[model samples]
Target chain A: MAYSNEVRDSFSKELDGIREAGLFKEERWIKSPQAADIEVEFPAGAEGKKVINFCANNYLGLSNHPDVVEAARIGLGTRGYGLSSVRFICGTQDIHGHLEHRLTEFLGTEDTLLFPSCMDANAGVFEAILGDQDIMIADRLVHASIVDGMRLCKAMRDTYKHSNMEHLEEKLQDHQDKRIRLIITDGVFSMDGDLAKLDEIVALAEKYDAMVFVDDSHASGFIGKTGRGTHEHCGVLSQIDIITTTLGKALGGASGGCVSGRKELVELCRQRARPYLFSNTVAPVIVSGAIKVLDLVSATTERRDKLEWNTKFWRDGLVKMGLDIKAGDSPIVPVMLYNAKLAQDMARDLYEEGIYVVGFFFPVVAKGQARIRTQLSAAHDQHHLEKGLEAFAKVADKYGILGKSKKEIKEMYGL
Target chain B: MEEYKKAILEYVIKEYLEDDEDEEITYDTELISGGIVDSFSMVSLKRFLENKYDIQIPDADASPEAFDSVDKIAALVVRFKQA
Candidate 1:
């Protein structure tokens, strides 16, 4: 056997515990492509259902756009499918260089390096730069990829209060004895849809002489007026030291990531970053499609404007219905349920009503902070928004979450 | 000891609850396990307590077990202060 009986028994017991604790994650299969509306394969006795998708990262609704799809098809015909070799060993192509250059231009950075995924980009950056002489101070709510990346490095690590600039300043002061200090944060916190105060962070970095790195995964393509990112929204695009983002979310809803920064850093990462040098480069289809996505988003702000308007409309509607929504301007709106069972029940009820959203609870978030995260897309029309609101109202009424004051809701839910 | 306990509990409530006056809490309430205080919050609390009490929390005592409740956290503070 691959494992001893004792070990296997322990593993089975752990899985049992997870199942009993209501923490077992079950994957729901989708039959159609990712978009505002998708066909989901239901379990036995239930036929496949087409539902309004409110949980995907398809913010700009360009994932399955006809133009992007056509671009990918042409790219596959021109460049073929897989690289079958790493970038150093015959993988770098003209399209890849074009994508990197376009990203650097779009992000207002000096250079950019591509990777298989944003997670890999994050995984490779920290270890490639920081060492024992450096110290890293990160926000408490940074993505798990960054936490793993920092762990792989030899730098002394400290986490400050989430979005608490004062706490960060104190940590920077405490670590002033280190040779170098790096401050890291996410451009937009996904769970809460809150933007980091990058302008303030940049000022503090200057004051403390620390380098700043931001993972702009959640805000790259459609955040600011021109859709630059948190840096643009916060007015510190030129001040950030390094930026890591993804093509997986707002760019194309495909899988790829990039690290954009100074020319020296990009050159260094190309030469030394393990994931970039060892792994196969991004697929031609994803690359070409992502390039098209950038062009489409940058050329016009119609999709971005529509997404923002839809988010505001839906968020205001939820609030008007007395739902306790987390306060933010990002399209990711979290309807706070407080109780795990209630969140799950609400998600199921909404799904039955033809609205698709996912419930998030403990481990993914803090305990007692259960919520239904609804992501808005430009693809959703006014009719879809109204229908989603109607579904939310019905579900909220059924759960006794409507018209109750925040206090009453908390008391009734035992929160 | 009473001062230390009061200070620690107040900080936890303010940090985690964001000064929300609606949620009632007590010193004996479970902090780490009950999820009122997560790992991230624990890091902030640890740093604050270390600075305020002038003590170092050893690596062995950094688990949720050490700072599970207000009472346990107070005791750890006292022990560290004495050490």
Candidate 2:
């Protein structure tokens, strides 16, 4: 049956409004594997070209690594492709249990439970645990998944100012009469790459008798001394109550996530969380790939060191070139370009110059906070960084965003 | 009453109008529908009003329609202050 004309017109009109406001999201096609340099097929049927990828979540560059590929191949041979049912219903395999145990050890948690994605882990945890007598206070800048999770819970919900401990304190005190309080935050805010002050949050949690939860999706497998994530980085690994992170980012860039924390909480999620209880078990290949990534990252800090070096190199180069880059240590660096149209144009120009990056604007961020978010990878060597820098310099020069004379740019970039 | 409006306007300007300093924020400036105020800003506004007026705003009343414009928020403040 077809929808009525009124409904069709309303939907089409809203879409038109989105397009007019430049908020429409367009997906770019990548024809090759996830890597530092990739073959990108243009939207207009243009010839595909190898471009330096600065937008992928392939932080440790294990997405297409030889060892990771071989592990997946072996997994296919030994563990099979998938289990068509949920974990409790004949989906649990030896590899699944092994991966869960490996994650628990790696994250330094008492136990762990896997989900289809960190998104599911986040969405399912709140409703399963919290009730009307509880209060959930979250950072306003947390990922949308957290917001949806909070909405599903039967708790008194409040959002503090982004990274504002004072506001968080106010909300915590406001709802102190509640039976339980849960503080939710993203370990590293994705758009700006700013780290949450976990030490302060832990202190507040202790004072208020609240549990702290950190979604370390963007920080896992590459942050801290041994790549254990924000809790480790903040020196509060033992204090954090719950941690939800993805294997899709630095951990091989495949598809799986887990909730790792206190043993009882993890067991509760395994039994009660809707996503884990209802969704199909994670594929054997991704589980094998994730285990391999953990082993590789744990054995040596070489890849993370390279990623740190590349991030500093690229971020410092952009700064030296007079770009308004946000100050942070994370590999996710955002170069501010205020205007939405300008950000979109810059991304297009960067792509034409053989550098792949994406523009973020409101409502992905606050209004007037448009930027080009460039994610660095360990696979990016010195030459790759130089080439990407050259492309960025050229694009900025063309658009006058470099804010420097031609001679100055050449001297600074040695172009 | 004017004092309440002034405080809210000042807060909005100090926070959201960093880039658009020249743009004026009047009483009927459409804070919610126009997207000048978002979820984060709305909560801040709610807290500011609650603290300043010494009133409690129930969760059901903490909505966009209840405080879409400065006039509506001003009315809400008056209603609660009287109650």
Candidate 3:
């Protein structure tokens, strides 16, 4: 009686509607470790096919590095597996402190505080800092985590057009009456793969006497000249007030995130962020692995350089084939398909051709803006790029969409 | 101004409410709160208006309340045009 048939029937009908609309997402089971080439089996139990993965956030190919794995093993042997308590309790391990300091030094921030994930860091940071007298002015295209975090806080929320410095400045001028005005933006937008105008944003914040916060989750590794992140790339390394980034992506691709920023703000989060106070601490294994990742990136920019070259090569290849792609300098590249069904069909066809990339459609993006988002990594060599290009060309040819613009695609397949 | 309202109405119906053919929309129809348009769509709509009118609408005047209906959107546009 608690779970009634009527409720179940309504839920079932909604799920069916999603499938009929071509919006139902199906997971492809990966049999091997996270890598550029992974064995995937779709529709659940079929045979696994090895495909060149172009949809992962593994920018530096450090996900399965031998040194990182060895460091994790050592951490497990030394620090044990899981912490039963939170950071304020018995969860504070020596390695945790070491990782925090290491991240502070790596990110060029005054201090850092670890979280279960970047999502948690974002969720807790806003509420920990701002109050009702303040306002949070964010970029419209900032990560969803930031949106949720702002909702949890009592501060007034407003958003400027994505990367529009003029609009941001106007918003800043509008909110001069507030006790504090916080400008929030992603260092790099994940879906569009576009970097934020952090230098302009920093200048605006300075002029308006506002605080600047950046969630560098997508740009934490292999983004700048030396991989210090967007702040470093924008020449505002010490000007940002708060920075939240993830260890989940290019930093060994295990799982951990942190808020690295001003010493007082970081201390405030450590003392007040609910997730840090209540949730279990990040595993020592992840912490140790992240330490190794920071050390590797700090030691040399070889992986970062390789990833940059791979992104350029892949982007040039796609462009040469006359496919419309979102213009970005990052490793994340999206091939614009426009229609949801076309994107889904193209992703399926590309999968059959031994390429692993996901179709992003409505809800994930705007209506009529569906695309196949492809990410490149240092692990992807010239051979992988060539093979990926071949597979994409075949798929594009199959759809007869080569050289077609978004308008043309929309006209062909109704969005 | 009436022409602006008509253009805004036509664009909203064609671009946003295309999937819901049965739904009726008018100059006073609720767009954001009624779920006919989302934040992303609103941003694009704002961009459309700016591009069409060749006027920059300040973010302060581009609130959800100001853009909830075609009549309100047109009024905002006129305010910017006059400014």
Candidate chain B TM-scores, in order: 0.89, 0.86, 0.93
Q: Model 3: how far is A141 from its true place, Å?
A: 0.7
A60-130 per-residue lDDT for model 2 (tens digits):
99999999999999998898988788999999988899999999998888999999999999999888787
The clash count for each model shown is 0, 0, 0
In Å, residue A308's CA in model 3 sits off its true spot by 0.4
Q: Rate the local accuracy (lDDT) of all candidates.
A: 0.88, 0.86, 0.89
Q: Which window of 10 residues has the lowest lDDT sum in candidate 2 chain A? A: A406-415
lDDT of 1 by residue, B1-83 (tens): 88988998888876666434455668888877886766645667787788888889976887898888889899999888888
lDDT of 1 by residue, A1-415 (tens): 6799999999999999999988998777888999877888665446889899999999999889999999999999999998898988999999999999999999999999999999999999988887899988898789989888887888878877788888789888988898989999999998988999999999999998999999999999898889999999998876788899999998988899999987877788888889998899899999999999988988999998999999999999999988889899999999988888888989999999999998999888876678899999998999989999999999999888887765676688865
- Among residues 3 or more apart in sequence or in different chains, the pairs in candidate 3 whose N, CA or C atoms overlap within 3 Å are none
Q: Give the number of the best model, judged by lDDT.
A: 3
Looking at model 3, residue A17 earns an lDDT score of 100
lDDT at A28 for candidate 3? 76
Off by over 4 Å in 2: A4-9, A403-415, B10-26, B34-37, B40-61, B80-83
Position A85, candidate 2: lDDT: 88
lDDT of 3 at A370: 88
lDDT of 2 by residue, B1-83 (tens): 88888887777765555443345689889887866776645766787789878999886988899878888898898888888
CA RMSD of each candidate after superposition: 2.6, 4.3, 6.0
